[model samples]
Target: MLAWLLQRQRPVPIIQMLCGPSGEKILGQLRVNSHLREHLRTIYAAPCGVDVTWIQEYLDGLRIPLLTEAQSEELEGEVSLDDLMEALGRMVSRKAPGPDGLPVEFYRAYPTVILPQLVQCTERCNTVAKSICEEGQLTCHAAHGASAIYRHALRRLLHTRKRARLDPDGSADNVLNLK
Candidate 1:
């Protein structure tokens, strides 16, 4: 398989893919990178994992140390300027750039300039998230109220129609009398 893959016509740079899906020993270079990545992800990705309901009792019995109220508050508190600066200082220099392709050195060079921007961006993101959550909750409440109102209305309508049907005259007068 290795020989066949290596011996194949040169297209892209020589990437020796020794291990692959069971069906295809060697994937063709003609296959797009995205497709190849998807296949690889499917083959290698960790599963969602097994259901742990059976071990719920055991899990519940396990004694876990509880954080103090103060400790919990501190942990959940908004990231401070000091915290951001400390984190920036702790970042290792000259390491591989992140997804943005910006090296740590760039931030280190102009800490003041970047720090404020980063903090502002984070704050804005937090605000937007909070607003979205509140809006979602309000929408959910409104929907529930509307659903209840509709159900009540429908039930009343049905009940009125039923009463009219049972009337001695067998007329829809009771239903028509409803405001």
Candidate 2:
């Protein structure tokens, strides 16, 4: 089982792409890659609905209290090999592998072998985060901003807003409490 899992899997092919904003289709590897890159650059450069000044004010208004040295040490100590194992055990096995292409199934099946490595990797990440935090950099917060719960809540809110907007009686604003 270990040997079979260790063997490399074939890469999934890029099968198709939309060539234009209006959904004109393009097929093939080279053209698809080039067109997709151009499309993504254009999309990424477009302004989102969020107001930068409002966001800046909101962040500036936040008054999160700093943790004491002991509290910081305690928080760091809370992450352990056992905690990593527990989290790994909770991961769904059938999800697609990341860029490394080693699936969750491999870790689930070989916890004893992988736990130490995972713990080390996590420790390194924690160290990097701590350094970034100490420097008063925004990178750490930005990188870890989206929790799973937050993502789910955002999705649910969007879905409810969409449903409300589709109602016939103009009650969507009332439902969402929109001005």
Q: Judged by lDDT, which candidate is best?
A: 2
Give me the runs in candidate 1 sitting further than 4 Å from their true place. Answer: 1-52, 96-98, 136-179
Error of 2 at 141 (Å): 8.1
Report residue 173 deviation for candidate 2 (angstroms). Answer: 36
For each candidate, what TM-score against the reference? 0.41, 0.37
RMSD (Cα, Å) of candidate 2?
13.9
lDDT of 2 at 111: 82
Model 1: how far is 127 from its true place, Å? Answer: 2.2
1-179 per-residue lDDT for model 2 (tens digits): 77676665645555565556677777777788888788789899998877699888898999754544553333234245666565565566787434567788887888888778755765566566667666877565653332322332222322233333355453543433433
Clashes of 2: 0
Candidate 1 global lDDT: 0.54
RMSD of 1: 24.8
